[model samples]
Target chain A: MKNMTMGLAALALLAVSGVAQGADDDHRLDDAWKAAVEDNEGVLSPAQVSGLNILAYESAVARLCDGIKLDEKKFAASVAAVVTGGSALSEEEQVQRLTAVMFQLGTANGLFLAEGAMKKDTFCAHAAEEKADKDNPHNWQ
Target chain B: MKFSRTGLACMLSFGLLALPPLHSPSHAGKTADAIAAGLVGAAIVAAASRHHKHHKRMYYDSYEPYPDNGYDTYWNNVYSPAAGITCYRAQVACYKANGHFSAKWTRMQFADGE
Candidate 1:
């Protein structure tokens, strides 16, 4: 009986450790994305850099939520789509993109992008899947 | 699609306005400076008016994002290609509305002439 109890505790510890390790793995994805942005040679104003950082961070979150299993094939396909479809925003799209990211993130959580925000439908139906920054990769943010 | 005559004209006028002024032969007199200022001012008003008129025609406030039916180097340099994204998944709204329009316009921005 004593040994069984010890085994259970050990299992719990392992599970908790797994969760922490998983979240840390997600951070690696975020860091890689940040590095990519920094690697980008495109000239940007301070404001633009800030905006891009927010977007990239949020986007990385979204991608993580979308799936952490990204390998070579998915990465290539996703890049092709964005490269092919992205608005290539004009000077104005910068503001709009930030706003959109906020809205999408806000709506995904039951509450807006503020405190007390939950995965409820008051904001949007797709909120359940958009957990971009919520430590959950399956969310809609 | 090609830039319409109106779009071309608008781009040219604004393009010139965006360019830096030519070096003055000499900055000796107030009159010379005023003349130069007037040229720039006229350019501003024309460009501003055109900007207003052009935007007024479309609902830019709710304007959707571009769809990438094709590719463009400039955009790639700016917004690097996505990881697994095949079509531009810009706005949830725009993509939900007309996925096709987004793609065509995207390619045009790249293929469209200067």
Candidate 2:
């Protein structure tokens, strides 16, 4: 009877510890999600808002390999590379770097959409180039 | 034969001189060889005087993911993102891997209400 009682007490202690750890994780997830939005404010287009929100949720996953951790090196490199790939040009080097970052965020969001877990809203911004050309005939000349 | 009319007088004299002596045919062949060498030298000099030239066009990487039109080439000139806190913050951390935050995170946040 005494041994069973001891086991029950230990089980209770472990359950409490598990709950505490889960709460800590929830806090981190919230922090990471806020960080993602904070990092990506004006950059995400209206179409990508949905994807970012989804990734924002993934930030909550406690495991490293599973979701996009706002604080991991691999994620950072991937972000930098995507940004480098999507980077825009600017007269100011600093401004140019920011442009590159926009590309990174946009491209990253696009990738997450491709994963099949997230559905993207069709944004008209994709047609900006077409509209610009349609409106300006002299552009081709 | 209109030797004079054809202006072969000087050429005929040279030919006669070029002929091997009736006594030594070998000497006649030597003179013909010298005349042939002189003509070849003149041809070589003419060819060396002429020249050939060429020009190459310029090419560059396309900035567009997939270009729909000709203007795609020019897009690379302006490839950059909007200057934001995230970029500034990320770059700071890039310089120093761990939390060496030079650029404040709040400074670059998107102005759009999230």
Model 2, runs deviating above 4 Å: A1-71, A81-94, A118-141, B1-114
Model 2, B8-89: lDDT tens digits are: 2222112212222222456435434433333342222222222211100000131112122422222112111332111221
Question: After TM-score superposition, what is the CA distance of residue A141 in candidate 2 from its true location, in Å?
Answer: 51
Tell me the DockQ of each model, to 2 decimals.
0.02, 0.01
TM-score of each: 0.18, 0.19
The CAPRI quality class of candidate 2 comes to: incorrect
Which predicted model would earn the best lDDT? 1
Cα lDDT tens digits for candidate 2, A83-128: 2221232222222223323333343343323321321121112112
Q: After superposition, how far is residue A26 of candidate 2 from its true place, in Å?
A: 34
Task: Indicate the worst ten consecutive residues by lDDT in candidate 2 chain A.
Answer: A118-127
